[model samples]
Target: MKNQYQVHCDHIDVALPYARNSGDGALIGSMFGVCANGGANGADDVLVVKGVFTLTKNSAEAWTVGEKVYWDNVAKNVTTTATSNTLIGVAILDAANPSSTGVVRLNGSFS
Candidate 1:
């Protein structure tokens, strides 16, 4: 049994693709996670791959609980639209139109 599990999968160290702030959502390839700390691009930081978090969302879109949510990497926000976006998780609460945030539960899966 040479192969052994080292750490819990809930969090991981990643080479940031861009400068990020703590609590920000990050998409690396098809994997999505919340930044546990702020860091410059190419810096090593921890990403929480699971758990619920309030994330930035499209200001004009409304969301209901259980609705699928996507990450708009360009805008750096969660969105209801699927096209050209990465599926990160689902809405865990209702988000009003003109709102800037939404509650989501991260799926912690690649795409």
Candidate 2:
């Protein structure tokens, strides 16, 4: 492997082995690059990534947004509703700590 480093992120995705129930309805993460502990041991507290954009403030519940969202699997934190989902304006903010490793697929708002 090359060099891997995680930074502050706003909208990202993570894969954990368990699921979490944080009522904040928002977290933070970094863009996809690569990590050492990047594993596929799906967790339960996961944000349940999918094509659904309807993420709500409810824990483990999916809600809809306008622009973007961030899901931290390891830390089980999340943040939704952004301005732009482009790679240029990628938003990533560091969580209380960090999150697990997973795919960070970007999506767009409906027209």
Candidate 3:
């Protein structure tokens, strides 16, 4: 097909919305993905849009497996709170309060 460029879209190259480190989760205008490399804001970088990853989360909040999670862009971490945040994925494992990380599977698309 003339319109076909590439098939798989599990990853994408985008101008970063903010400075990021490798493995950082980013939400660029409703699209969410994990940074494949670290770069300054506005730099073009590959974002992995699918997979399970251990990401930094709110240490004060606990998470249960299968619970929907959101990206706290201001805090630069994951949270269970839905208010004013972007939904990124679901927790794959339970996380305890004061824990610094949580396992998540990226949804690859917004609800």
Please, what are the lDDT tens digits per residue for candidate 1 over residues 19-87? 999999998998899999969999899988889999999999999999999989999999999999999
Give candidates' CA RMSD values in order. Answer: 1.2, 12.9, 1.1
Off by over 4 Å in 1: none
lDDT of 2 by residue, 1-111 (tens): 255343324223555433223322222243322222333345223232222322222144233323234443344433442333212112232222123221223332111
Poorest 10 consecutive residues by lDDT, candidate 1: 1-10
Instruction: Supply every candidate's count of residue pairs whose N, Cα or C atoms clash at under 3 angstroms.
Output: 0, 33, 0
Q: Determine which window of 10 residues in candidate 2 has minimal summed lDDT.
A: 86-95
CA lDDT, every prediction? Answer: 0.91, 0.30, 0.92
Off by over 4 Å in 3: none
How far out, in Å, is residue 100 in model 2?
22
TM-score of each: 0.95, 0.22, 0.94
Clashes of 3: 0
Better of 1 and 2 by TM-score: 1
